[model samples]
Target: MTEPGQGQEPERAGSRAERLRNWWRPEGTWRRGIVLAVLAVLLGIVMLLHSRIPNDVGNLGSLLETFLPWFGLCLPLLLIAAVLRRSATALIALVLPVFAWVSLFAGQITDKAGAGGNLTVISHNVDADNPDPAGTSRDIVASGADVVALEELTSAALPKYRDGLAKAYPYHTVQGTVGLWSKHPMSDPQPVDIKLGWTRAMRAVVTYHGQPFAVYVAHLPSVRVKLDAGFTANQRDASAKALGETIAADPAKKVFLLGDLNGTMNDRSLAPVTSQMRSAQGAAGDGFGFSWPASFPMARIDHIMVKGVEPVKAWVLQPTGSDHRPVAASVKL
Candidate 1:
């Protein structure tokens, strides 16, 4: 072929690119299939680098990270679309998300079960409005956890909680709306000031197997994301900070914090606590084990964190008439 003029090369290349774009979204092929493929790859990138997103829009980074793993579900859908439409470009783009999804989450997909643990800890946010607090407490007690921390212990339900847990766990303490029950002896149960003008958090020392460690139970103030304002929980953020300070300053050789933090580990607002301690679920659980919205479990708000302890297993329990499911973890003390 004869060599094209310099200006003609640019025009020809532009025409070729236009033709390629048209082919990518040709009417003969499914237009949506092409778009879906690109979207799937974008989801992978977003999940992998969600931290880079600005949190100014209601802490958007966290909102995405909270459901990051779920984004992988779209990959298969895109692949199916590409196959049904027989679009080579779309099919090839599928590789991006397939690997991206695997790279970002493959490590978490495997199950690490059957490991023995010296201690079992569970945390739950018992909805304050729960009609049967006693039944709820009974269900948690039946889990056989060595230590149990419960949040949203309303005044009306406190008596029922005390009565229900007294038989299985003789050692228990309640501070504000948070409470802890232990099979072992516990002491020094004191309220942790989280600047909520109320006792929503507390710390206690428990002697397990003749070894003592500190445990903290907290119910951080609620956070709201409204149309006008984003993550409107100024109080919750402050409460988390105060709780983190308490955990950091703690003199105990070992520490365990369990409760409803009202935020996920991905949320930077709770970085104070997440930074200092390790999430039991993240360390050993089979899956995300979301604990909130008991009916569906879309996010994990109930948590078990530890310092100076190793997690051997972690899991989320079924709903027990509460708005949140119970989270349990086995630890090597």
Candidate 2:
């Protein structure tokens, strides 16, 4: 040996390296905590800057907004992991997403309890290929809507819906693929051209309880998002613009639009309609009230919008053997 403590120094240095490896190993809980915290940070960033996400690629921003509510699931899972591992770091990091999500969506939630409304109205897109038109019509009648607007009214199912609702409504009119039923007198049924060559929209004046109001029913052309073209459905956009123009031109002091617009209020593609009218759901619904893909609704594509009426309640109806759930709203004329 060269020196008395020289060999001992080498041994201590080797032990130090081993200890360092142990501290930085994959099995450490601290590493897991760090990962969770980083995820939380990423979520916070996404929530805060969602609008910046480019839509040119595939209308990715709108697609994200469509299912944005699901993002809230992250906080609970992170909190559970933190509790199980006693991870203070992850627990504290959860505050990021909590604040982020709250800031973005909290304002949308509100109380909806009310005494009642003067009129009940409903809208639906009973899928043209529905197998049981009778059952669907029965369910809608049971909903007790004073005025009902129906879209996607195919030749095969139109007669069934008319006969099924005749007794209850007494007054009805259908123009093109859309129709309207009311418990009061109806006048001047006209087709609204949505740039579709053929008609898929209509308007009428429904006189209920001595008050006549303009009602429009439409089935906007569908939109598609593909790998090559993004969410560019030129036809639907053109139709929406035309519909907006027609509504703007109408002379009625009170106007209501009911339809399967195929786009949510949040989608920029619907700016024309959303900008012109106030959504009954946005004003009075208890919750998001999504009404599509009847089995598992993820978006509120069906709508009841009003220009000069006051909505007192808004809600989504149960499935009626159709792909889209019916939407209902009560209002004061």
Candidate 3:
């Protein structure tokens, strides 16, 4: 027969072992899953916030904004997993980020149906190495815009553009690589000198339907890619700031700014200009209307912005000879 003391020791050791095993075993696996789902939802919210941030220095901000929308997709997947696992708490937690993202983008969605206007303006990059400048010019003329702004006008190709555009646009001016063509009479045509050495931006006053309005055409510096730095967009951002200063000084209440900004309207770095002006596309465009590297346009780098004018319709034209597609819009004063 076993002694009483010996029997008690074995029973105690067995109890201790069972307690340790229970502790090591996964407790509330559903709870852990819920934590993961919540994390995913929070990540999505952060991405949505990041995308809305404007580009301050240039490409760096734009690069971040470009991928911001993808974040929203993550939340839905996480929600699905949470539902499948029956983690009701995790599923409910996702509501916070979902509502947050919606609140941020709700304005953009609602503002799309813009008020109507009576004037039309067009802006195009018309790449410097465009193979068919003539074709591109013809396309712009056909747009029936009261004012047309073109950027990246190389000296070798300016005459071709002029010859092709002269018939439709009677009054025109070229300041370095930037130019403005108007069906109406234009006055006070001059270079804006956005960049110190290169005059790739200009401004003019156009009398459209007998009303004089200030029009600015600009081509901000292009950004470059570097392995270490990602995108070197500082020059473009600086140019945008300078352009903003110029626009602020303009005495005209009604103004139109057109160009290849080398960034997007979503980019916060451009707040200097974006806050003061309004994008025609954002006001009336039906879709994203991407216009870069014309082969497969993914993002809108070209833009037409107006102040004290009404935007009625906006769209991107088919590619011609340039790497960027043209953007056109109709507006009224």
Predicted candidate 2 versus true structure: per-residue lDDT over 289-308, tens digit per residue: 88988999988999999999
What number of clashing residue pairs does each candidate have, in the order they appear? 0, 0, 9
The top-ranked prediction according to TM-score is: 1
lDDT (tens digit, per residue) of candidate 3 on 10-107: 78999887755665344543454657566866675565567554544445557866545445676788788777776656676787777766665555
Writing each residue's lDDT as its tens digit, candidate 1 over 89-168 gives: 67777787778778867866777654779899999898988988888988988899999999998888899989999988
Root mean square deviation (Cα) for candidate 2: 6.0
Root-mean-square deviation (CA) per prediction:
6.6, 6.0, 7.6
**Structural similarity to truth (TM-score) of each candidate:** 0.87, 0.84, 0.81
> Which residue pairs overlap in candidate 1's backbone?
none
What's the lDDT for residue 14 in model 3? 97
Instruction: Tell me the lDDT of candidate 3.
Output: 0.80
